[model samples]
Target chain A: MEIIKIGMADLGVAKPPSRLRTTGLGSCVGVVLYDEVHKVAGMAHVMLPESTLAKNGEPTVGKYADTAIPYLIQQMQKEGASIRHMVAKLAGGAQMFAFLGTNDMMRIGPRNVEACKLALKGAQIKIVAEDTGGNCGRTIELDSTNGVLQIRTVNQGVKEV
Target chain B: MANFTKFGDFQFDVLREIGNIGAGHAATALSKLMQKEIDMKVPQVRIIPFDEVADCVGGAENVVVTVFLRVEGDSPGNMFFILDMDSATHLLHQVTGISKTVQEWEEMEVSALHEIGNILTGSYLSSLADFTQLNLQPSVPGLAVDMAGAILSYGLYALGQTGDFALTIDTAFFEGNDQVKGNFFLIPDPDSLPILFRSLGVPFDGDY
Candidate 1:
């Protein structure tokens, strides 16, 4: 398997027979898009919820969910991926800092998950599976061949998304 | 109150020594993990009152990684590893051997970063234990958001009023062409403060 590791604030795309993975998702969001027909997969690890929070207005396609998702879809389309056949799997957005209180402004994890959900919804993509919330951080893996999303959290064994 | 003379100089000195030892071990661990020679400097230590922590650290824009270690019997306090976002990402990439362009802030990635935090904090506390002969055991480290204000707020919330003082140390890590800078914030209760200071050979002046 050609495995590609994605780091924070990075994005990756793969066709059939390729695998994409990202680790350490505390308050950060991971988005996986799979096109069943074309057998192509794309994943993005977004650091912030929105690109507006970015220092400059330059706009990074994979740095935020709002921008990254659309960008991923476009890239996949260029690769002959069909929108109707694409399935979405989301992970991460763990509340690594519970002591900060469960409030909106300070809770980046919940906000990240919310933003991802909203972005996918706006893009008309159905969220086939999701693994989110809680106090522990997570690591996620996406298999482009079978569209399997796997999530692993500390002390909490790996589970399929 | 000793005229507030040299405030916590002695305490700071001892903490710096402890930071040196801890950072040494951390550098070794990091070097092995990154498969490169890492240069580390002795950390600069400071003791700041809780209310003034934000000012001392230059507020929230700076990235910070908060680590919680359990001391005494079941009371887990905090240790913060503060840094800039670019440096944090750079260090993370180096430690994991993952390229920077493939950035994906996923759970495993965060866990990988947490693993580094765990190793660094573990080494730090181990050095403290060896020096002070105190059996202070750290808990399984948990990850907090990477912002100074968020980390400080979380630490304050966890320790409450008991967290009267913070022991901070600034250090730098260099690996060939890449370098990263960071600080460790130790938030301990008043009762524990004296114990920590005394462990570091700081003379107490019988002043609150």
Candidate 2:
């Protein structure tokens, strides 16, 4: 019953009877990978879509979807969780502002969601559930014991997927 | 990231002056709207890590109202106006004379708050534009009620592309025994720094 907290541009893994949580996902995506058979879960707070977009510094591997997905899987494998039993669930990736412009950066929410999906698909991981692309912010929690992804937002109530 | 860490006290003092002028105008606008005296603190300018941005208002899970705008033009950047739930409600009551009772009433309340944000931030931007002689335009304001971390992170999108740190120019304001309190944050894009300082005729040597 320990709940591990993941900060922005960070990732972590947890076992059964434990949960993985990340808060304040806005224009960012929270991707959860779970191995049902092994009861292992991993969560990542991805700030951007691609690693190539990083410049002037060493980008945090957990900060981009293309890198974070693979890194999370690697960590899960080290925990003895097999890829064959892994399924993905996603939340967050919301557009906190609107009508700014058609600039790709302005549509970061959809871009993050699309990027996460592409990365997950590239890894051959099936996405079982998702909540994305709204104008509000979300905080997500992954319950490893039951593989339930809980999403909370303001105005809208909490929901479990 | 390390570059900003090297900012001297003089540099920070300069940024603080920018915030003071900008927020001072915003305070004037807010006072006119609410017909109440508004007092703004001396602005604080800092270069902070991305993970700590939301801590200025509260923790990541702290629910609050936010109005965000993208600063586009000569010096592109991000801007945010934030308020806690209680302060938001107080402002709504004072401005629109509406009391929240029904769930459906939330939309109207949010709209009213959005206009207030638009007006205040508009004034803040205009004064900055005038003082710096830079062509700055604010995009349409977007409103959301959510965890402070989530809403504030949107302002960091531009900063995240190049570094893990963000240079934040922030100002906090209150009115009448703290019944209404809010914060304004301005984060310029990494590349926009030189443009900003150049427009102001400040000597720039690529160091903070």
Candidate whose DockQ is highest = 2
The candidate 2 chain B region of ten consecutive residues with least summed lDDT is B99-108
* Candidate 2 Cα outliers beyond 4 Å, as residue runs: B101-108
lDDT of 1 at B104: 53
How would the docking of model 1 be graded? incorrect
Off by over 4 Å in 1: A102-105, B1-208
Best by lDDT: 2
If chain B of candidate 1 is superposed on the true chain B, what is its TM-score?
0.75
DockQ of 2: 0.69
The TM-score that candidate 1 achieves is 0.51
RMSD of each: 14.9, 1.8
The number of the candidate with the highest TM-score is: 2
